[model samples]
Target: MTQKVLVTSIFLHAGGEVDHLLRAEGFEPTYAPALTKRTEDELIGLLDGVSGAIIANEPFTDRVLAAAPDLKVISRTGVGFDSIDVAAATQRGVVVCNTPNVNRYAVAEWTLAMMLGCARHAVKNWTEMNAGGFKRFEGTELYGKTLGLAGLGGIGKEVARRAHAFGMTLLAVEEYQDQAFAAQYGVTYVDLETALEQSDFLSLHLPLNAQTRHLINAERLARMKPSACLINTARGGVVDTVALAQALREGTIAAAALDVFEEEPLPADSHLHALENLLMSPHVGGVTTEARQMSGVRAAENLILALKGQAPASPVNPEVIPTARYAVSAT
Candidate 1:
């Protein structure tokens, strides 16, 4: 019997040779509906007999995992797996893996674009220009500015590399102890308080976890320089959207550009909608065509390797491989 693999990521199987890869492995690939995420019940229904899955930011809670006894492996298209319950998956001997560094350049470019947008008032300028009004707001340049990075992972490193070319001084608040990277990029590691107080632009690149949930709130927003800008191309849950709205309304910071939100497809009544100093994108920072092709193929490869009882390249819970529901083994 050909094993079944469920694919929920919208970016996959469209342009990439994902189907060819899966079929070559003798695995039958089944795609879920479009990008609209499925509820827990819907997910369980889709995963009925699936032995492997390639998922997006869909909810795969413990209940859903328990309901799907045959599920052996989950390959996430992106680096962040906060949406999945890794602990529960590990406990049940289900291997979880993610494609890291696949879309690093795309996200890094988007982050740099957001920073430039905030500095040059891209949103307001475009809005005004389309309205048949001529209003040229004074803009600032990125040159010789201080950029504080909240996390220095793959994406952050790319951002730092790009920022260095533009003559930006880098300050990072990171747990990644890569002294070589720091020395090469001239990144000054600092505490959160110092980074916030001194940075001209504070960019976020952290995962959404217990300690990182709403890491930026009213108090921290108030700590930034009045002329500073905030950029978040990372997880939405890292910043408090309500507090961010109020901060923009009251000019707590000069401006902000956000690609992710606490709520996807931001509600119509969201206070963020009324802010003039805010720029927003619909979480497209890592969804470029090139990125989609690379990440999709990488995710498919992860699933295929795990299903073959071999170690995946980017296993989130490698400890489970020895006993991963008979789908994968440490090799």
Candidate 2:
């Protein structure tokens, strides 16, 4: 029987190059009908006979993985894997791979857009004017403004490079600092607390993990300057969603722009929905036509390699490969 791979990454074309690539190898491809994320139950239903999965940030919990006996590999677009239960996948001998650096520039560009939008009150002004209310608002220039990055990784470095061109001051918080890059870009290394207090635009580029989850909460939000803006193109759980809603509602910060959310689709009754001070997007920060294609191809290659009983490009849990369903030694 031809092995089946489920494509839940909307970024990957349902019938594009990767689809053709899979077909050429005699592998069958199936796509999720909608662009929305799939629940665990939905994923279990989708993975009935699937041997591999090309996914976005779908909830692939232990229960879902346990239900799919045939699944051998999972290739996710973009770098985040917080939604997947890696320990469970590893225990089940499933290879998990991620496409990284593919969306770095896309995310960096989106960060700048969000920063500028918040700085200039562009979203609020546009919303007001569209509703027939006329008001000219004073906007701040990025030049000479302090930009504190929560994490100085690939995306953060790109953001530093771009912000430097605008003559903005750069500060960053990272566990492992790149000394040469910091000196080249003139980035000041600081702790998260310092970044929060000093930044005119506090942008997040960190991952969501144990130490970093809810890294920004009520107390931290209070530390920000009243004229400051917060930009999050990274994970949403970094900032306390409830605290953020209260802050935005009370003008705790000048404005904020978020491309990701604690909850996907940000329910209709969410407190964030009515805030004119908040600008929200459907988690499309690391997304552009170019980036999407790069990520899609990388995800496809990882899936294809793992399915062929070979080592993938970037496996998160390489230890599983030896005993993984396909049973191959790591290259």
TM per candidate: 0.96, 0.94
Could you list the CA RMSD of all candidates, in the order they appear? 2.2, 2.4
Tell me model 1's lDDT, rounded to 2 decimals: 0.89
lDDT of 1 by residue, 1-331 (tens): 7788898888666334997888877788898844664689999999988899999888889999999998999999898999899999999888999999998999999999999888887877888999999999778999999999999999999999999999999999998668999999999999999999999999999999999999999999999999998999999999998898888889899888899998786778888877878889999999888898888888988888888878989999999987655753322
Most lDDT-accurate candidate: 1
lDDT of 1 at 320: 92
Stretches > 4 Å off in candidate 2? 127-134, 325-331
The residue ranges of model 1 lying beyond 4 angstroms of the native Cα positions read 14-16, 328-331
lDDT of 2 by residue, 1-331 (tens): 7788899876566569899888877788998843675678988999999989998888889999999988999999889999999999999989999998899999999999988887787876887899999987778899999999988999999999999999999999999999999999999999988998999999998888888799889999999988888989889898898898888888788888999888887788987888888888888887699998888889989998998888999999999887666843222
Error of 1 at 220 (Å): 1.1
The positional error of residue 161 in candidate 2, measured at the CA in angstroms, is 0.7
